[model samples]
Target: MRYVKYAAIRKPTEECIFCKARDEVGKERENLVLFRAKYCLVMLNLFPYNTGHLMIAPYRHVPSLEQLSDEELTELMVLTKRCLKMLREVYRPDGFNIGINIGRVAGAGFEGHVHIHIVPRWNGDTNFMPVIAGTKVIPESVLDTYDTLIKYTHLLRE
Candidate 1:
């Protein structure tokens, strides 16, 4: 939702956006990042499949789930569950489709760094738009979704 049909603001193609966000000290809002934990962080997808599409990824820059430590894995799952609960409370989605695309062969957009995508689904959500025109019509802004998730962070326990 950052750019509506491409109006000239282009992210530098060389750097990984997620890695850049993890390293940046005070660019959370600009990066559309929602929350950060000890090992992992949650952020809105730049090109979302839905209005509230979010992703959780480790900050250590591992390329796969097997590269994660046990503690890091625990935190990732815990926070993932929490994201689901909070998203349900906020969006009241009919269902959710969550998974990790491990490699480029498996459809990983950022194949260099592993991340799990959490997409909220609703009845009649998939229309003929993408099928007919190749554009997904997300009805909300990614920043707005980021703010909504930030507000719900109050409900999460450390």
Candidate 2:
């Protein structure tokens, strides 16, 4: 079992992380951005909850879904469906936890920039480590998972 610590506490900054990822367009691998669409983009979670945890957000920063236009909303769900399919094809997890955290009170890591999280889940994926030792056991590293998912980004285009 490989234990991975959670991400370090990030110092408060004015810049939104999603915007940074969107602006650094060409460096997809370095940015962990898998695919970019006209209205939205998909990127791997830097501190993933699972091996293939992914996030989808609009190119334009918005705090909530209500702020999104019809086009942006449509593409968001479209990309989300594609992500689900991609995760299904790659990880073959028994289940998934797909959700959006709209506000800071609702567990939004970046409350100012709304996004959806797609977390791949397997049976017994959790253990006593996180409960007792403050660490989680991840079978693979984030970079390795990024490399694996990068290969499937093309499939998302279709």
TM-score for each candidate, following the candidate numbering? 0.89, 0.92
Per-model C-alpha RMSD = 3.4, 2.7
Q: Model 2: per-residue lDDT, tens digit, 37-130? A: 9989899887787899999999888999999999999999999999999999999999999999988688777888899999999999998997
lDDT of 2: 0.86
Clashes of each: 0, 0
**Candidate 1, residues 42-153: lDDT per residue as tens digits?**
8888888887788888888777999999998998898889888888999999999999988767876667888889999999998888789768888888888887788888
The window of 10 residues in a row where model 1 has the poorest summed lDDT is 1-10
Best by TM-score: 2
Measured on C-alpha atoms, candidate 1 has an lDDT of 0.82
lDDT of every model, 2 decimals: 0.82, 0.86
Candidate 2 Cα errors over 4 Å, as ranges: 1-14
Displacement of the residue 61 alpha carbon in candidate 2, Å: 0.9
Error of 1 at 121 (Å): 0.2
List where candidate 1 sits over 4 angstroms from the true fold: 1-13
